[model samples]
Target: MNISTIGIIGAGNLGTKIGLQAAISGYQVNMYDVNDKILARSLKSMEKLLVHLTRTQQLTGDEGKQSLERIFFTEYLNLALQDVDLISESVIEDLEIKTKVWQEIGEIAPAHTIFTTNTSYLLPSQFAEISGRPEKFCAFHFHDVFYSKVVDIMPHPGTSSEVITILEKLGRKLKQVPILVKKEHSGYIFNTLLIAWIDAAGRLVTGEIAEVEAIDKSWMINFGMTAGPFGILDNVGLDTAWHITSTKRNPASRAFAALLKSYLDQGKLGVKSGEGFYTYPKPSYKDPDFLK
Candidate 1:
């Protein structure tokens, strides 16, 4: 369909990052969100990020300006998607919400337009059921903070090779390392490995086998310290991690569920709220509560 205009249905962190990158790559980008405030906030954040990239010489001033100019943010779903060649849905993680959004996109988007989701847990086959045009839909997963780079391209049984070709090409244009996988597994490759690791850590934390810092230190120091489990948990947000783990209702995940519930009950929501597993004091440090 000679894809050019890209439409993103969510304007959160991942959406903002990917939309900005696509726009910077010279593709027309349209972002849609139900909340006007969220859309505005995302736009402001994107501007700030582009300015930083320009100042650091990662992007030329002219390039940054062009990128910012290329992106258009709106609250109307139909308008944002009208002429889009590709639609990427990054809406709430709930399956019901995704199903409705995909169904609407299928009805509104151009017939040739391809639809993709950034869901981490739900299988593409399940999402495809809602898209109606399953042959033209797939899962285009992106890593948080990594933008278009390091994406997992998963196609459902119904998705055609042509759609995958276009998506992979677009991913490359956006500087993403796109890997095509055949199965419709939940969590795909990264999260599958990550969830297993996290489950193990959860077991230790709940059992009080070691203090939080001790456990964190052992892994960070032993595994090169790029990102400790606590740091990741914090970054992912205690509430988010809790929900992800709670979906399966496993005994190993119960501790995290309880911990997050307790924290939320106390109104501590991590870095956004200036606290979580750690305290945010200029240079934040782990909170003792995590250890206890």
Candidate 2:
């Protein structure tokens, strides 16, 4: 199905990026979150980003303004899901919460509407077992920067070819490159490979192979600024990196878990709580403070 009005369940970074990009692409976007405050904050953040894009010549004056007007933010789930042609779930990473939300979404959304999850670990089929529309469900993983033009489209055993085809088309419309995964699996393609590197990095950090600065600088020198792992982790939030790496550790997540515990104990959680592997000068999205 051609997705015109898209509903996004979470208004976090990924959700906000997708929603903003969808809006810019001339698709009506409705973003929903449990907290009204977050929804309001997300709207403000979207406007700020659009303004920045306009200044950078990345977006035309009319396009930026139109994109801002295309997004509808709300805390009401039913209203957001109603009449939406496609819904992308970007809520918390927990399966139980996702299942609960999808079950509710299944009951509200039209049967023909496509349901997609932005989960990195959970497969689309698992949600189908509990959610309402299995055949129409699939995985649409967006990178940290949705506008980067790269997306992973994963279809499970229950997903129909029709759904996959439609999602690929939708990805193109949003200016994203769609890479399909034939089967469902934890971490799909990108994250699985990324997690391996992340695991090795965590070990290096804990084992004192190199300080965080050296590890981060090495990647910057090789892959350029945005490609560094430690820098990326700092921007993504240490808590999030910890959550992703929690599944792998020297002692089955023990080493990483202990590191996370100690970091939290010291009250450093990266950009969010102010300090992490490195301290932040301000809460802005500048590169992670390398030395503190």
Candidate 3:
């Protein structure tokens, strides 16, 4: 499985992050979104990522620009899928929409093209049939490609061993530490741990056990972590968080979901919208003494 060319469906935060990361890894990336506006935003976000990477010396100025040069943004799905060896989708987490997209990809993409979803909660098996090649479908869940370096890959039962081997290599090529899970699990590895931790943080706030700032501060000071759960929420995007919380059954979780929805309604979608649980580009969490 030679996968030098990658197609990323969905130009949202995760999609854009994946593309920029792919570019940095020297792969030709095709970023596709149905909405042109979303595609434009993704392109701008890629430029900003390149600027940051260059500023941090992760990439040279020329390297950053060249990385950007390799990304091809398109509203036309067919063009983006052209000759793509692997397609990773980072669309909304809804099962229905994802299945539909996979069905479409099954029809449009080449027969040998491998299909992977960047879904955190849903399992690949749920939509493997629609993918046209269950043997080639798997979950390649990435955790904030910029900061977190891990990508957990869970292949469905029907997925081929060859696909798993190729994806592991691809993950390394993208400069990620890939963890292979033999069985399909909802949320795989880090996120399985993360969802519980975040839920507890949200419950604490809802129960008035601590204020949002206080909760994050406590975690940062106690653990020497760079960012706490609220800070994590900002990075995860309020919309995405809200969608994840929608799966909860308890009252506290519902309250947290509603709170996230309120923020979403106001367009304060964290890093993507520039305001979420905290402000972005210069959130207070970035301060050296924020933990204090």
Among these predicted structures, which one has the highest lDDT?
A: 3
TM-score of each: 0.90, 0.86, 0.83
TM-score of 1: 0.90
lDDT of 2 by residue, 80-168 (tens): 98789999999988989999999999988877789999997888988986777788899998986544667889988988898899999
Ranking by TM-score: 1, 2, 3
Q: Evaluated with TM-score, which candidate comes out highest?
A: 1
Summing lDDT over every window of 10 consecutive residues in candidate 2, give the lowest-scoring window. Answer: 283-292
Can you tell me which runs of candidate 2 are displaced by over 4 Å? 208-210, 214-228, 249-252, 281-292
Residue lDDT tens for model 1, 1-292: 5889999999998889888888988999999999899999998988899888888888998898888898888999889998899988889888889888888888888888888998888878887867778898899988854433588899988999999898889888888888887878888888888778877877888888876667676786676654567666766777777777776666767776786778777777777777777767531324434323
Error of 1 at 238 (Å): 0.5
| Model 3 poorest ten-residue lDDT run | 283-292
Give all candidate RMSDs, comma-separated: 3.2, 3.5, 3.1
lDDT of 1: 0.82
Better of 1 and 2 by TM-score: 1
In terms of lDDT, model 3 sits at 0.89
lDDT by residue for model 3 over 1-292, one digit each (tens)? 6788899999998999999999889899999999889999998888898788889988899988888899999999999999999999999988889989999899999888999999978899998997779999999989888888888889989999999999899888888899998798887877778888999999998888998888889889899888999999998888888988987889988999988888999999999889998887899988987755
Candidate 3 residue pairs that clash: none
What's model 3's lDDT at 79? 95
